[model samples]
Target: MQLRQMTDPNLILFDVEAESKEQVIKQLVSKLAKEDYLESEQPFLEAVLQREEVSPTGMERGLAIPHGKSTAVKKAAFAVARLKTPLEDWESIDPTNKVQLVFLIAIPTNEGGSTHLEVLSTLSTNLMRDGYMEGLMATNSKEEFLSRLDIEEKVKSNSDKKYDKTVVAITACATGIAHTYMAAEALEKAGHELGVNVLVEKQGANGIEDELTPSVIEKADAVIFATDIAPKQKERFAGKSYVQTRVAEPLRQAKEMIQKALSNPDGVVEENDSEEASQSSSSSNGSGGFLKDAVQAVMTGISYMIPVIVAAGLMMGIAKLGAMPFGLVNELHEAKYATHSNELFVILHHLDKFGVLIFKFMYPIFAAFVAYSLADRVGLVAGFIGGAFAGGLHHTFWGIEGIPSGFLGALILGLAAGYISRFLNQKIQLSKNFQAMKPMFLIPAISVLSTFFLNFYVIDPVFGGLNVVLRNWIESAQGTGDVVLASIIASATAFDLGGPINKAAGAIAIGLAADQVYPLTARVLAIVIPPIGLGLATVIDKYVVGRRVFEADLRVAGNTALLLGFIAISEGAIPFMLRNPLITIPINIIGAIVGASTAVLLGAVQWLPLPAFWGWPLVDNLWAYLLGLVVGASFIAFANIFIRFAMIKKRELAA
Candidate 1:
């Protein structure tokens, strides 16, 4: 495995000329072919090009390493080039880098795993040493250059280097070939130079190498996630002080990243220390930065809330259905006053109470996660207290029960708790010994008190006042414009799919249902209709139109949309909406309006804040709800298919 045995001088070129990235690659790949190391030049060339598409192989200091793993390679070999003119057009990890030296490595598919490790351990190690690359460029002859590489000292000076601290790291890139190993080597060397033991795990093409054990992770002082994708088993480093960055950053700034991790080994990641967690994929449709982060937190809250909503809704629905056969639907709707004598009926009554109790935690879990996103674990206590008050946790005074603002209370209080805790952590000056007090004691106290005051004085009064005004207006107006109100709210819910309008629509719907001024019939119907309708259109496209209306990729996306629709995430329809905003958005809005208004006018009353089929039994008139839902969804599905097909036909005729 000596570097000298791997190649001959004929493979190394000097004073090379290239105008583009492709030209340079072609020149190098031609050498591998001429040397009979490759079975096919074109196939291997395509392999290298496909690797480049994932992420460029360029590094700082005017160096690029383009590599490929293919069966077309007869042997594992490499070619080097010292360019006369820099390849300015080459895409690089560091955008400012213009390639002056290129190393092209070819590995046979059979020996890919073993050879890649050997190539990286020997070649990448030498490249990390100071003046190693400069020495390569300075050599006048190929024989002299080969001598310089071999004659260089091989013994490690860091063998005697003692370490007191340990930093665990995970390095991964898009291809998990070049940049991944380079970053790991760079961190290990830098850690050695700094007198620290940096244990690294490489998640690469060869699979997990030097995997860190739980024992080692527990003993480590800090963590570094150098990855382009989310690192596997990230929960292992949950409480550790950490830094997260792209895979290639360590090739240049390895020491700096390590030092920051060492200094803050007992706290949440500071804003100045590293970049924020990669944006949540759910928030891709929103405005970026703070707004995106806010939406991400909300989505996280929503994700946790789903199980609670589904379980509670399903249990309640089952209880209601079971009681219908015995003429005890009213008695078993709530367990508070169950008059049933039979053991079977008694169990159903208990299930009804359990479901009602479980529903109370839905908003709390939502708020807790939202707070976790903003302020980490310290924000949970305040989130629960605020959420309980927001959902009206039954503390009565003067014959009035708890004043519940529902989602509005949870949203406001959760955000407040997160920001306040984050601010306190950053602003409060603390000695080294007192750092533990910030997350455990100080943060929870201040956050909970703030939540109590905000909920009691401000949020409660406003929502309570609105509820009184709405109750009066609803009773006086009776059925006047009931469908109009439903139409407006439902339309807004699907107006932009998962954008701001769509997100805020939930709160508005919940607000209307707080005091039963209007039932949640419209809101729940609107939630599932658009995504399910759009999803159905794609599935039945060929059947109805005698040809596939959507492309191959979109057909797959439609199946995903259909699955997500049952879980009531409107984001499933986001792709369709994005593809034809004018067509899809308006149609979605109209569909939601029709579904909501129809459900409302038909007397399908739903007082609870739940969505999807699990909530169907909770509706006062189940048949009416189903009928309205079918009518509205069918309109959207058929309308979308015919309009898009006609448009396609017109384009075909013109062609």
Candidate 2:
């Protein structure tokens, strides 16, 4: 009913003395075990470690909220520990702050989802004000600390009464500690102001712990799910009032979703049905949808793209490996693994060509599926029309001395198909028999016709004109590099996990792959380097710059994703940025731009159009890729060091 109702004072440790954040965390967790707050220290600690491996929880204002929702928690509990000395956590770039303040919140996923938002909102808002952290640090007794918390809670609770409608929400960042908690607080504050009963369920690396349980779901008017990672167990809210969004948006948009849901309490929008439709379409076509749809589409797309990218990337790699001896053409006859110019070699070459052919198969499929996710059956036809038209446009524009507008064309087509399908779905009607036929006849026919004409007359010509402008711009861009451009692009890439900026870059690479003109390996390497570099930098600088709480997260992020990065995967870096954007993005951007600029300047040409793989050398200049790697890696490492030092300095000033 109230914050203290859930918090056990026995679990709270004030003026807790520990040398570092990790030692303090372990001490606090072990203490929780002693107090019977957790079933055992090991499971709870392991969850903390495991989750942190994926994401660090070091938040703004020299605080570390390391939490987990796992089997380890015997009861929902909160503990506070004030370190005698700051601890080194992996994700903490500001070395000065080390984690002096640590809050270890434990909850069982099954009991209720962890109320991470409540804890974070309670803590973050208190920590944010000028003297609140100093007040916290100055407190010498549990009574003093409790008093501070009580005061903060009173103010927050009063704010909660302002909302006219009450809403419960679940907020999760991949790691579950900092951002999950912060977003939770944000939503709560908004709910309070709007007079809503806001509850948040949190899922973090620690596993699912104390949260708004099934009862909460059953009682609440609606639920808001803000997460970047896949939720562990989602069956509880099957038909409940709910909506999903990224973790950060809730502070601003969640209140609105709650308002809408409350206004029409019985009219909650469930994405599951639409998600399934798009996934089915993805299996047949390529991929499509908003976050859920896109995720499914991407999964399907990757499944389809893998064979082609592998065969092509490897063959091209082999060819590059043998480039000198074969003198390009003659080497086709030389056989190392298999006889070249022999049936085996010819067959392999044919497979390589087939792989390239399959690579082409992905574009239309991807475009169509994307449309399908947005507009269902009608979207597919429109998407196909758009993709096919884009292909033709590429040939006409770039191949005809007009410069490539393939990326622009594909985007337009996908959007066009989605809108067309949406329009038909809204305006078109049919009888029962016609409804069945509608998908086959009405949706496809009109969609295709609309897509074709739209692409032919409007999309093509618009991009055609834009291509001329873009080409001139690119030409002028030579020797005109600016730091602002680099910063803006890099920051945008790091701002959201797999959001628009990520897609834009990915779309460009995909366009290059489709053209068969530019090399795929080069583009993928550039894409892959950012996450890898930042991850490594987090690892390398962990000891000096991060708190122990963050080290757990960095270990997960740095280690779990490193292998994936070697073969050119970008998703691996998502957790790092998801938890701490302000700190993570700058470091990631520095790494990405360093890699991209270096690769571009070195003329690191890719012979094959494929995703990243290490067994084969896909690029014409392997060293250039390595150069990008080094530049990216070094930039982040240095950034971590410098940033951490600045944090240390700031803390000293405050102290």
Candidate 3:
């Protein structure tokens, strides 16, 4: 089918008002769905975003080509949107351009074989032609615009021009869709202008094109390695002078990069292990490809947040355990703290209070780092602001004294801040003298304000309402029976290991405990059970199956998990969940539920922050608590082992 067959007038939106690139994509994707171009919008949207994480599609002269391959798309199509406000932080190869136009292409993940390459190639070539984009901008009607998509020849270089220097270049990208060709065309165009003979070997999804022979490499004076990943056969240029950069760098600086390669940039070609060094230099030298994935950004945030969680929990645990001997600890009967005249009690009370203070900023820290991951230092201030809102810092302003949104809130705000700050940094055009104001003043102020607006109108209200509903349910659940309450809390805690859902459960349970709704017995035990259980399973797997069931590294993780579990850190079990999430998650939930329910039925009560062994003395029924813990952990351990053994036996029988 022709390019225009994929685009309907209904899919072409004009004068769309959106502040960010994400909003624009969603708006267009929604339109595509309304026009029956997609079976579902979210999966396709996610695919497009995944492509974005690999490398931003924004190009020079106010254009962005964001495409995705997904089963959610019923048909391959292109949608165009002309935005009223230029999206600044779209991460266009040319950082200076504010993206006013977007070409969002949807390719069916399963059916996008050659059709995918054809669409991307046609669009990329049409864009490369002289005045193609400018012509589209002048079109007032959708039909006028659609007609522009007709087949067109690529902008040609002067073939008759003579050159003294010959540069052989390689262009590659993670997707190998649009960028590979775009970079090649840019290099050729630059060579034509500079009177240098440039031959490009494209390493793409379709494999290498215009393959470089030994003769070409031998004759060339310099080489340009423009790629996101390591180029194939890089050793061919080991002894030759080379310049390394990312794929998109050529879009804006093709001439400068070609010139630099001719100069033989230092540190790229070292004496020892020169090929490896050159490859490493090429990867590191590029400013792009640093933002790996959204999940990685979240994990990075979680990693940074983990130490804070552990420290706050440990401090609170110590204070609770220390105050127990002197009868200074608060119980259901006593609403007072451990602020007794004894110096130790007073010190412990102060420490407990300090822990609460530290816990308050946990969400904000999680958010700030996540933003830092996505948008670098520019996202820090905005992320911190968003996280503070997520943490319910404006409780007085909102007039709601309940639990904060916790991890979920932090994640949302962190990502939002990163996108906003990054966008403003890229979009806002400033002159040389005032450019310093962009990052130091303009970006932070605007991003923070935008984040505040989002939380004020949306996040706080929604989460606060959810909190109210959750609190009422907890009170109602406790009225009927402790079993119901314990099961629910324990299940939620074990659900995602250390994900936002776990934090959400923690927020509600801890808030209720503070208000004396129910003891923390279920919450604390549930937190420890999964890690301990997973650890035990790892230890017994080989014995149960007469062969190693898990990888060697998992066994090491098992040892660490066992120790961490005893100390009430649920994050230690995260490795197991990540490896086999579908089975592991359900098993963990069941184990936690059984353990917490058993503890409740046996009258094991603990309302304090002490989740570790040190707090056993403070528990109302220590024997019942111990039995429940063992029963839950053992159930999880044995169940996991049995399932693994069955799988192993089945495989052997089949063999």
**Deviation of model 3 at 505, angstroms:** 7.7
- Candidate 2 lDDT over residue span 475-494, tens digit each: 34334453333333334343
Query: Which scores better on lDDT, 1 or 2?
Result: 1
lDDT (0 to 1) per candidate: 0.71, 0.56, 0.74
Q: Compared with the true structure, what per-residue lDDT tens digits does model 3 show for residues 365-456? A: 87887777555566788898888887667773669665555556677788888777656654676676675676778888899999988887
Per-candidate TM-score against the hidden true structure:
0.46, 0.45, 0.46
lDDT winner, 2 or 3? 3
Predict model 3's lDDT versus the native.
0.74
List the candidate numbers ranked by lDDT, top first. Answer: 3, 1, 2
In candidate 2, stretches whose alpha carbon ends up further than 4 angstroms from where it belongs are: 1-14, 17-20, 26-50, 58-80, 84-416, 427-655
**Winner by lDDT:** 3
lDDT, candidate 1, 434-458, per-residue tens: 6666666777899899998898799
The TM-score-based order of candidates, best leading, equals 1, 3, 2
